[model samples]
Target chain A: MLNHIWLALIVIGILTAAGRDIHEVSQNSYGNGIPWMLQIESPQTISVYGEAVETSLRVPRRQLQLHFHETAAADAVIPARVNLTHAREGVAVLDVTGDVPQQFKIMAEALGSGETLTARLRHRGSGWEAEFDPVSLVYLKKVTNAAFDIAGVAVQIAIGLIGIMALWLGVMKVAEKAGLITSLARIVRPITVRLFPDVPADHPAVGSMIMNISANMLGLGNAATPFGLKAMEELDELNTKKGVATDSMVTFLALNTSCITLIPATAIAVRAAAGSSDPAIIIGTSFLASLTATIFAVTISKLLARVKMFRWDRSEAE
Target chain B: MEIFRTFVSLLSAIAIPALILFFLVYAAFRRVKVYEVAVEGAKEGFDIAVRIIPYLVLMLVSIAIFRASGAMDVFIAIVRPLTDLVGIPAEVLPMAIMRPLSGSGSLGIMTETMQAYGTDSFIGVLVSTLFGSTETTFYVLAVYFGAVGIRNTRHALPTGLLADFIAFLAAVFFVGVLL
Candidate 1:
């Protein structure tokens, strides 16, 4: 019974992690549906063989087996392996083996036409024992291009960004006025007191600016920018002199940038969009990338502010 | 406008009690430290995060539904040629760039893309790999800047966006060469 509790906790922890890894939902596994085949046709064929005429090659369905459909006298029919060549050169899109044998090659009848699987068969009683056609042996060369897929992902993400932005903007206004519009906040901060309450109301502009940044940091960037800019105009009232960017502005920017995320929800969304098996990788990458970017940005901006260069830009505009 | 105004008014009314309730929970939990108090205050903010989860899940499901429903596949079929012209897959195209903008939405599209094409296929692998490595620079920059109150996406955005372009080009070229 020694260390019973500790051992039990360790076992519990292991089980939790395993469950997290291969997250099975009620929906579906990776490839659940591939239609059964009836007939297959080779689009093109080239014979380096000195002989000819045989039965169609035997190729399996799930396992893609290759059997010789060659002539009985030529002895060309059998299970064998072969190399497949693509029509294009410098295009690294083939999964053919280096030195193929009989088993790798399947009968032509195995892969029915109107389907997507096809293989080139070759049997060499010589050196490399691999199949090679002057032209490509199969019809496999990126059925879908890469660039277009990325763009499609980008568009969907854009829509999500917009939706989040709009929602966040609405929420910010609600969170802010939650006290001002009601008698409850008055009970808390004293309703008999004034709306100005000493934090220095610089127009609803500055307050809205702060809220804007807060919302974006909350991952509502689509809706935050305009509100933030307007807040600067609000904060302008506080800078009655030559009109310069204040420490609060820089500090606010720094915090927003460095706002440690609660959930890497957005990156997860991207990973899902990208069709990754493990979309959770976004959690780690997002933390590291966002943290580094935010720290470098906020720190440098603050340091730059100490010098005249930082303040001069805004003041000069004033 | 009336609905908006009423909602705002309602939230204002509720916020005071919410703050108090949060404070009471902190006290009850024996967390009177300033840091804990501050964190407990953030727990109120944390509640908003939790509320957003249903949307995230729904969005992902709908994306799956879209692909399963064949709308996304058809969309990709139309997009494939155009994307092919630029060296991308129609299915992978929307998600590659958009994912950086919003993770949840991109995930939905990603589900669709993977369903249409073999996820292990060269382009699928490349897009998935790149999606992990790349940053949604604009969204991150915008949010971070806003959270802390930086106003100029004017310069920061350009640099970040340019970096994004470079990353995109590099991913395409690398996959073309290697995979």
Candidate 2:
């Protein structure tokens, strides 16, 4: 299932990018090779040759409609700096800032110019004609860049976990050695017995699972991860079929993903940052929602385990 | 409600240090060599992290492609009608769909939604509640299963996704009740 889903994402992403690029080409989306007529509104007279002079470039709505073929295009006044080496030939850099069209911004970025777009300018009688580098296959370029960037970021995320993982795992090791984990498991036997019928009640896995779920409930994600991973390692020790997830693992994962919330800290923090009068307003709602999902998650995990395809006996590593 | 909020916040803040202190002190009292044993256990952390590199890279790269290609717009278009039938506001549909796939993507959507609609608005509350309630299913699956080298994750993905779906519905239902 994971193999298929993973393949489908890549296939769909590539196809969609190709389709969009083809559509853009057919529609002349970026007005490739088309020259734009713009009005220069600054620098009363061209005095400093080969020196950049701050200027304002006015793009008329009619010209916008002609170039991009969008009837709804509005007149845009862009702040720019121009370097004119001759009366007829010059270079203008348009600051791609507030209120600019989305297409134009993308074009600027695709052209490798971060926040400014450079265009070749020619003095045409009363106005200037500006020609921008053609942009094509933008979606494909974006998809390629994203894939490469995230691959490295994935390693960074894993490396970043080393310190935290070590800290929590070390603490958990001490707890286990001191016999604290065994007692913790004993305290939670009634619940663990039902949730994980396969694992023994006094097993250390139950202790780690309990700790994980508690950390998750309190929104301690960093702590939750190490404990959760520890639980997986312990549970794996009981697996008869190596390289396959047992029913207990599935149930634990289901519970973890939809664990009940005591405080939705990240949500409240974002709300507060966004200037909400009552940032913690979602606490009750989040708790209720997560509780409902967690109940269903556990039930679903148990039910699905009995199905023929997903039954533990039928699973084998490919 | 205020008291509960304060209590949980304080608990989460103190949880790590307190747990570390308690475990170390208890182990010391029990005559366990704390530093040596902890270092031995910490050694496994590096191996587990390094072992999961392949899984994490492939999983995150796929998700990044889907997001960058703007396939989500098409995906939302296809699912919009089904969601509409269930009384889900079209505005928060992106949040529901993105929540399971990518954490940062959904965070961006949540922030953007709140900025567009006031933070106190119904849509704003619903999106945040949705974000708060569910984990990033794919990420969790990758990291957790990846650590153990579990190749055949039987029933885990489907269960997690279904759980996330239920969480979205519950959020919508509860947020509706709240407003």
Candidate 3:
């Protein structure tokens, strides 16, 4: 089943390696031409509050188009340099008069000095109206060391061959026996039990967690897709409320997302391939971040889950 | 003192592994005792590592291809509309963009994102940090489900996908509103 996918991956690998010159495969993908959407996110709705608030729409020179009058000024859309002064602390609106998109949306948020907001305008009958908040464009401040990027890319390519090499070289049987696969299963199992104690092993969450970890251990994050989803559904069963997400489910998601990625053999090896001075700089960060996020996310989710709305809902008819 | 200690610790972690290899090789030569156990252990590790090497290699190669082909641009573009609908900022698309790719690819992207923006930039840090913490859901699911011989992942896919989605949103929310 994954043969097809793996095959495609192989072709992609060959082509990517071959075409590395043509592709601007950055260690990071965000380019300056596009404006970075700077904003805050809230589950509940955010009201605009005051009328005609002065919000600065920051667009990356790539995405932002400039114009002197009504005539088209630049060949490319980009974050145009603008001259403006701010008043006080509250939301301030700035006059944006230039070549804008016919109909588009810019995701936005408040920023200091250069308050950022996304600007979305529908090319209506008359003129453009704001579809979404004004968005600002921010460029990449940190560039992964080009050499580091090369190393990172190289590691990725090497991993692509790990399975093939393993099968060809012949340690797969030992792997099967050693329960190396259980490392992942062990990590995900108790989490499954904690989340769905009542659910059976064959149930979606328990089974998927097992399967998901198995795939993950095999270095197949893609393969783990179905299992993760099944796990979620089994978890969702505990959420009896509607329109609101449950705390346990949310926490479960956080813990999983913030999963402490123990033993980054894959990454360290990648760094080794790329020829990094410190292949393990990632070891600490990965460990620290994953653990912190797991704890923080789980705690928050658990706290919020204590609210009554997160409980399992029963049918009115029943 | 603390900073110096951290640097020392970090150096030891890096060098210790290499030092062990040297010691093992030395031990293998002296009494040949270390070699006996190590050879057995390594034989096992090497075989297992090699067996999984193909899987690792396949994933790495494909990600390389995705990077090389500019498919990432198209892929990111295709998903851009979906993200906008969901309220994820377009700038932060790199994290979402790299989500489907290998960890290194995403991490590199995350690193750049942090540099482009400030580390204090909520989304920037959240995303970069999140990329490190989170596993690629579909990738993990496919390999594991396939390995176990449980083809009918009908229930499993939804559960994991939901987990991924929720995680994505939570990261965005935590960064967006709280941070």
Candidate 4:
């Protein structure tokens, strides 16, 4: 399944890039008009002008580059604001000064289309002002971005995973050693038995499955993966047909895949790192959402098990 | 309602410590040799982490390719009209699709969205709630089922997708009412 999905992404990326480049070859110019949103706090008159350039089509594609020149009297206290806006899309606000005129480059998607770009300005606490004239910006068809992004993002994520996985795995070890997992398994045994009717309550697979789900709920990601693997291996031991997923396996897999997470520690950490005012605000809503999802996942798997097409055929596996 | 809110907050504050303490206390009472067992289990962590790296990297890279190729944008544009009617914001469509595919990719997208839109905005809450609620279904399937060598996944995929769909809707609904 994943193999096909990966192949599709690469193929679509290459095709889209080739198609767009083909169209670009016929066009006279790759530049699009972008409107600027300017704001100044000082009383002195100010004028700003700029053009966008296409820097590179290689890995880490630099889609657009903007060079803007502003002529204004220097003031230490007064604030200067420059922002790009699209009608339906959001705004990207930048603070600029005449002292150091740095070029700006942003993702092409963030700036919207070439035609609809608008610049709005606000002066000295006045309402937002707009310029009808749009700045000419160049566009590029980045066909290889996906390929590069895949490689780049993989390295980035792998680096992040190393440390996080180590920490969580250590904590999980402590929990498992302390007999917390078995205690947790015992507590949730009733629910687990009801969910997986085929699995004997006393079977070690049941305990492992509960531990996996518990680890998931506690947001012990690394721990959960191992427990899940162990659970599957144990469950497979009882399977009548090797290589064919039994009803119990399907149920367990669905529940593990859609389990409700009580503490979304990773999300909270990311939000807090980004300077969110209240990182934990999503907790209650997220719990409710996960609960809904788990219920649906369990119900759907059970319902689907009854369907003739989805039913397991022991002979087919052979 | 206010009291319930306080209770949740209090619980959240103590949840982690409580869990840790419960384990320690239980093992101590049972004379389970906590320190030795903890060390023995911790030893397995290094190997498990190593084992998962290839699968994790594979999923992450594929997701990056999907996002960078602009196919996701094209797909989103096609679905916008239909999803708009369902109140699924266009801003969150990337997240909904990627949530099942890759954990890191979706996290990056969520962070980017929160940066673009203020963290307090509607989209921010919706995505954050989504990130909190949903699991990386495909990753789970590949790692767990693949470990057991189960080729005939049967109803697992559909069941997982159904759960994700419910999670998406629930995120929107609960955030709408609560936030």
Candidate 5:
């Protein structure tokens, strides 16, 4: 299932990118090879042909409509620096900053530069004729960049986990050696017995699982991850069929993914940052919602375990 | 309600320090040689993290591709009608689809949604509730199973996805009640 889903994402992404690029090309979405007319507002008139001047260019509503093919395109004023090598021709660098059209911003990005687009300008009758660099295959370029970037980012995320993973795993080791984990498992035996019938009541896996779920409920996400990973390692020790997930693993994950919420700290923090009147307003709602999902998640995991396709005995782990 | 909120916030703040102190002190009292045992246990952390690299790289790369190509818009377009039939708000459809797939993507969607709508509006509250209620299923599946080198995840994916869906529905229902 994971193999199929993983393949589907890549195939869908590449195909969609190709399709959008083709559609944009057919529609001349970036207005390739088109010249735009603009009014230049320079503070001083340049007598020397090779002089550079700071100016503002005003793009008319009609030019915007003609280029973007959108009737709602409005007039825009852009700050620019122009260096004229000849009386009739110059290179104008338009600073693509605030209030710029979305298409222009995309075009600037596709040109592989920062927030500045360099365009060739010619002195027309009463205005400057500006021709921008062509932009095509925008979506495909984005998809390619994203794939390469995230591949490295994935390694960074894993490397970032080393310190925290070590800390919590070390602490958990002490708890296990002191017999604190077994005792913790004992206290939760009645619940663990039903949730994970395959494991012994006082097993260390149960202890780690309890610690994970408790940390998760308290919204201690940093602590929860190491304990959760520790729990997986302990659970793996009990697996008869290596490389395959056990019913107990699925049950634990189900519980983890939809664990009951007491604080919902991240959401509240985001709300507060967004200037919410009552950032913690969703606490009750999140709690009730997660509680309902947790109940259903456990039930679903148990029910699905009995299905023929997912039956533990039928699975052939590599 | 206010007091409960304060208590939970305080508890979360102190949980790790308290747990560490209790575990170390208790282990010391038990004559367990806490430092050596902890260092020994920490040894596995590097190996586990290295083992997860290949899995995490592939999983995150695929998700990034899907997001960057804007296939989610197409996916949401196809699923919108079915969701509308069930009375789920059209505006929050992106959040529902993204909640389980990517954490940062959903965070961006949540912030964008709240900015488009008022922060205290029903849609804003609903999206935030949805975000708070469920975990990022794909990420968790990759990291956890990858740690143990589990290749055949059996029923884990489906179970997590179904739970996320239920969480979304429950969020909508509860947020409605709250309003």
Candidate 6:
């Protein structure tokens, strides 16, 4: 199912890009000039003509055109000597002089400084004029570029997970062997009993349920899967309805869905790999969110079980 | 507020290492062959990671394609008004929607979000919190329940959806306060 959807998306992306490319061909401005949308992600100091000034720039400036009248104020064009540099693939780099600092400040302020800003540029005699925040230009770039981006990210992620997953799983193994899991399960025994009243406290399902929840809380996804499956199978053994789910089954699913995760290690690792300054910062917020979700899942499942629409018929006991 | 943020940061810094230390010491006291068990567990972990790669790749690729085709942008635009009312940023709508459907998909989206917004940015933090807190409700249901041949899922779908909804709101709230 997913494979088909993926294929469809690829086809659609190619078609869309092709259609746009065709329209672009028809417009055929080439060197003659057409309106250009400049997307500036951030502003920083860049070397332009042996001088440094804060500006929005991309290197190798062949197509680089500077007319501040678009995203910047109508009168914000600075009277500076434009020094052009190399440009590649329709991107350019350029250095400008004259009241550039003041002009750049005005444009930067209008561009919101820290966020992505888009400006419109159109032919005006030998130069161009630009406008701000034209929303129509926002679209995902080339599908090939996105595919490359995802491929790099996926491999990076898979590699990153290896060490951390190994470390935590190894510790978990020790804990399990030491009977730590059972001890941890004991702490949540009362709640599990109430949730799965049909299953005996000593049943394997109960132990598996506790272990599954604990693994999830510790952000152990791979460890959680087997235990969760085990619990489901164990719970299934006691089910009188062969193909139908029991109340305990539904409740267990709900609980598993909202299990509290204490450390978002995977998320943090991805962030860290992406060069986040503080990778662990999301942990606290994640904990709070997971805790709330768990409360809601457990409570809502219990409440929904009592509703007539969801109540199981005990009269059809096998 | 600054102090609180610092405290939270310190708490996270210490939590995992502390937990590992406590487990090691406790296992030692119990006289479980610690090194052997750890190695064995690590092997299992390795196997699980290997097993998940195909699924991860498929999900990630699908997400990449969906997003690259501008479908995600359209989806976000459509839901922006409703999300705005609930304080969920438009930036995180993909993560929120994908969370309950597929784990790898949500993780991929979160990675993309972090890359786009900068990991420390508010939107990045919000998406990460949402990604970490929620489960792949539909995937879990299909995999586990289907494995047992339970054709009737009863209230699991609704309950899971409810949980995901609460998780989305909670993430927005917690990130707002703490991050």
Runs in model 5 lying further than 4 Å from the true structure: A43-54, A86-88
Residues A1-318, candidate 6: write the lDDT tens digits: 223444665676666655554554454312124344333223222234344233443211233233222233233223222222233122223233333434333333333441233343343453444344422111234466567777677566555656665776677678777877667667677887888888766565777787677777766676577667657777989998886778888888888988887777788788889898888788778888989988889889888778775677732222
Kindly report the docking quality category of candidate 3: incorrect
Q: Give lDDT tens digits, candidate 5, residues A250-277.
A: 9999999999999998899999999999
Select the stronger candidate by DockQ from 3 and 5. Answer: 5
lDDT of 1 by residue, A109-181 (tens): 1233212123333333321122222222111111122223434554454445444444433343343333321
TM-score of every candidate:
0.31, 0.98, 0.38, 0.65, 0.97, 0.55
Going through the candidates in order, what is chain B's TM-score?
A: 0.51, 0.98, 0.62, 0.71, 0.97, 0.61
Fnat of candidate 3, please?
0.09
The 0-to-1 C-alpha lDDT of every candidate, in the order given, reads: 0.40, 0.91, 0.43, 0.64, 0.92, 0.65
Against the correct fold, how does model 3 do in TM-score?
0.38
Going through the candidates in order, state the TM-score of chain A alone for each one. Answer: 0.34, 0.96, 0.34, 0.53, 0.95, 0.45
Docking class of 6: acceptable
Task: For candidate 3, write residues A128-205 as lDDT tens digits.
Answer: 222234222211111112223444554454355344433322222232233332343455665656654544433434
What is the C-alpha lDDT profile of model 2 across A1-318, one tens digit per residue?
888888999999999999999999999988899899988886575687988888878998887787677784478888888888866689988898767767778888788855889999998879989999999999999999999999999999999989988988887888889999999999999999999999999999999999999999999998898899999999999999989999999999999999999998899999999999999999999999999999999999999999999998888987
Candidate 1 docking: what grade?
incorrect
TM-score, second chain, candidate 1: 0.51
Model 5 chain B: lowest-lDDT 10 consecutive positions: B42-51
Q: For candidate 4, write residues A33-99 as lDDT tens digits.
A: 4333333333222232232211111101122222132332332221223332233222223322222
Range of the 10 consecutive residues with the lowest summed lDDT in candidate 3 chain B: B146-155
- The deviation in Å at residue A268 for candidate 3 is 16
Q: Rank the candidates by TM-score, best first.
A: 2, 5, 4, 6, 3, 1
- Runs of candidate 2 exceeding 4 Å displacement: none
Q: Rank all candidate structures by their DockQ, best first, as comma-separated numbers.
A: 5, 2, 4, 6, 3, 1
Q: After aligning candidate 5 to the native by TM-score, how far in Å is the CA of B137 from where it should be?
A: 0.4
What are the candidates' interface root-mean-square deviations? Answer: 18.6, 0.7, 13.0, 4.7, 0.8, 7.3
